[model samples]
Target: MEKIAQPQSSFMKLCRKLSPKRKDSAAESQHIKNGDHDKNRHIEAVFAYMDANKDGRISPDELQKSFMTLGEQLSDEEAEAAVRLSDTDGDGMLDFEEFAQLIKGDDKCSEEEKKMELKEAFKMYIAEGEECITPRSLKMMLKKLGESRTTDDCRVMIRAFDLNDDGVLSFDEFALMMR
Candidate 1:
């Protein structure tokens, strides 16, 4: 693969910096020691985006719409359930604190379950009988997600997350990128 000299977008830089290697205890401990302020800031940004009406709360409709914008089909019932799970004050909406807590609680899922979800997502970009994500597969997935990038751009993205330097993303690399 020919290495392309593409300027990294801020989002891409953040993704690159945040990509965790398998069992990188040092990085994990650093994130914990720093009090996860960056993570909290990201959560706050997401909350702001989901609060479509700017009422300082996320309603079920807003949640559903926000997820839809991200290409995830969040049904109304599922959104209501999510709000109920986090709406501690019985307000039927998610305030910033409640939203933060809800996201934090997502970490409670078992490692096995998380791995299964990651595996399923990884499968979306791989061909039948393939075990890794090549630039071609990634380009196709990115196009499906409404982002049009050249194959070289996809190669650059894969290189950013390809810890093994093999010009492709294995399941472990994909899991690390998701982290």
Candidate 2:
């Protein structure tokens, strides 16, 4: 028992008014079904993940608040930085759904190269100096490995893990490096 997909009657009427050539140009099956709707639902799910406010859209304010709510308070400066960096649409606000789509859709890798790149990135970011991965060892490893980054002249590496700005790397933030 397969399901079916149906365009609204209004859409069907509009299609009929078009010339035969135009009518079939769209080539929509009148009985289209569940799979199409399922795709829409998946889209909604992605949107929901990014919509912290549940306001139906993802505004910069909402995004900032969501991050802030997650204990990552963005100073006004940081919020501005984030918006400038992430609001790809330049729409001045991100809809919850669109924002969700952006993150998931923003795969900066070709599938074929993903595994190799991931391995290299993990090797650089992770510290396995000791029997197990540990924060102290990880930081040291990053600082040493980052010495050769394009900005090789400066010790600007390993600074990103100090989430609290406490001049020390926390355990959880170190874990994020695995990502």
Candidate 3:
């Protein structure tokens, strides 16, 4: 049997409209490079894991349970509110696309807020008073996160987004890499 194609959600449409166009083939290729591909796959894996009972949709209970598994407590009201925020179909459950939107966060977040959050995350890998992230810092952060990687591997990762040909990642370069 042929599978039916789902309609695009308004959130996705807005994202496409707001996102920048690729400059060239190289830019397009880099956009889908290994790290991004792995991130997307990881998101799918998490969503699948959260959707208990083998259902395509995630109910509020399932979402709450998933949060508990991660050692985070989520109230029923909060879970329901989260589902309502992204439930375009009013089904009271989240399909994969809706879940993705929830994961990305609501549209209410401002650009400045996003930048602040990114800066905080970036700071986690850098030393005090340091403005750039070096390979040593990146490798140390990755190790702390349970993903062991060599300093050379971290250096190559930074080189991919090192726009100024610098050996480290400044905030601007890190922001671009996050995108």
- Each candidate structure's TM-score, on Cα atoms with residue i matched to residue i, is 0.68, 0.31, 0.49
- CA-lDDT, candidates in order: 0.66, 0.39, 0.63
**Which scores better on lDDT, 1 or 2?**
1
Output the number of the TM-score-best candidate: 1
Q: Which ten residues in a row have the lowest lDDT in candidate 1?
A: 1-10
Backbone clashes, candidate 1: 0
| lDDT (10s digit) by residue, model 3, range 1-179 | 00000011222222221221212134566666764555445557656767888789989899778656533456787777767777999999999888776655533455765566556556766866778999998887656434678999989988999999889999898777766
Give the residue spans of candidate 1 off by over 4 A: 1-27, 30-35, 123-151, 163-166
Q: State how far residue 149 of model 2 sits from its true place (Å).
A: 42
Off by over 4 Å in 3: 1-40, 46-101, 105-108
For model 3, what is the error of residue 7's alpha carbon versus the real structure, in angstroms, after optimal superposition?
Answer: 28
- For model 2, the stretches where C-alpha displacement exceeds 4 angstroms are 1-46, 49-53, 84-90, 109-179
Root-mean-square deviation of candidate 2: 20.4
Sort every candidate by TM-score, greatest first. 1, 3, 2
Clashing pairs in 1: none
